[model samples]
Target chain A: MDSIDKKLLNIMQKDFPLSSTPYKDLGEMLGISEEDVINRLGKYKKEGLIRKIGGIFNPRSLGYKSTLVALEVKEGKLEDTASFINRYQEVTHNYQRDHTFNLWFTLIAPSRERIKEIIDSVERLPGVRKCMNLPSVKMFKIGAYFSLDEEGEREEQKSDQ
Target chain B: MISDRDKKIIKHLQEDLPLDSRPFKNIAEKVGMEERELLKRIEEMKEEGMLRRLGAVVHHYQAGFAYNAMGCWRVPQEMIDEAGKKMSCYREVSHVYQRPSHPPHWPYNLFTMIHGHSREDCEGIAESMAEETGISEYTLIYSLREFKKTSMKYF
Candidate 1:
């Protein structure tokens, strides 16, 4: 990506235009045509760099309860346990981390009872030894913005060389 | 509380917006509302805190942040607010939260999701966070593999 792409991403991450002609607004800011902005973002989406360009809702405000869960499955049952957990639509993020409690996942449900139901079922799994339901008591931050300036600098240096 | 019409609008907004110049117009058409009304509803949602922001969600790994670790700090109850605020100030620290800790087996109450270009970079950030917070007891749980990662579907 070029500097323009980097700047475009930065602006989008901070606050995307809420106007009717957002792409045009983005184009005016980037000094590019609306078509160009659309094409670049389209390419990025197709290439898997851009996940989605849409509304990020506050789950809590939407009456959803979310928790981070860690499980210590028996040595060989890691894959099986992950698949089982994935079956629930509530499980959004699941990962294998480097710890005794290797399997970690995030669950968001409409009610506290639903969260407990899912956890209870997972605990009943044969290889699952332990489960920890860590719900956020206080959330300080949640924005995941990555500045691409350094990469842009590297790109510029490469072209100069 | 969101109205039934607001839910209909949200169902569309939760997914990807059309890539065209008149994206919201297209959405408004699909939702059987005028573009102005759709935008007004979205604005209201933002004002009410139901919607955080309308923006691009990038794949960090593809965006050059190859390493990410969940830095778990066992902060004292009295110091949690201070420590959490301090950790949240770092650009590399994307998420900072205070959670209940399960003792004996698990004893970390504060969690910060740190991302970097490398594993060492992540560790260094955590180390500096530890230094700044004066809370040295911490663990950086690096994700070995991503089994699943997707946005929540709320209607």
Candidate 2:
């Protein structure tokens, strides 16, 4: 990707405009046409440079009670336990770590009772030995944007902004 | 450059972008605003760092780049910025961040993510990262399956 592409990516990752002619408006700013913007974005997606380009909202804002859950399963059942936990739509991301409590995932439910219900269901799965949930006490979230082009004092730049 | 009206325009846009030929006109009609007004608000948001371009959100596995793993490194508190900066440079590294590590419970300090076509591809990135950081003890947590990918709603 070129400098322009990198800039486009950096901007898009944080806040993608929700507009019908967003590309057309974006093209106007970049001195390109809407067709060019569409083509470039298509190419970027094809290249795996971006995971997704859609609405990214705060889960809490949507009234979902979410928490990060960690679990340790017996040997040889990692795959099975992980799949079982992931089968629920409430589980957003599930990963197998190297620690004793190997499996960790985030779960979001419409209510606290529903979350407990789901957690209980996950615990019932065979080979699941232990489970714990750690909800974020406080969020210092910066919304995950890497300014690849900006080479110096990025944190400072953000604070200044 | 963005005002309250611009924010409202985005709130409407998030529901769904019109899929027709005259999408802007369609959006304008729905939002009870003129096309020019809606277009102007979008332009301001872009300038103000509030909105990027609109586009399609792809399903990675559907497209066949399915090997995605979250690799965490145990960087000392002093080296987090250095490690995060280093990890951010790699093209393979998509997401990089620093999360609190509670040892005897949670040991990994720095988190970096890489998505590839296969497990071997992800392993390659992990091995390379190990060599780069000179940290022998780390974790490569691969996703066994994806349950949800929907973005949370703002409104």
Whole-model lDDT values for every prediction? 0.87, 0.64
DockQ of 2: 0.15
lDDT by residue (tens digit), candidate 2, B1-155: 33556546666755545433356777778778988877777666555555433444444554344566778678776767666776666666666656666676667767777765578988887888778867657877766544335443332
User: Which ten contiguous residues of candidate 1 chain A have the minimum total lDDT?
Assistant: A152-161
Model 1 lDDT per residue over A17-52, tens place: 888999999999989999999999999999998899
In model 1, the clashing pairs are none
For A1-161, candidate 2 gives per-residue lDDT tens digits of 56666556555655444455667766776787778877887777667665555434344544558877778889999888877876787777777765678788888787899889989988888888887766653332223344446332111012111
Candidate 1 structure quality by residue, lDDT tens digits, B38-124:
999899898888888788988877876778899999999999999999988887787888999999988899998887767898899
TM-score of each: 0.95, 0.59
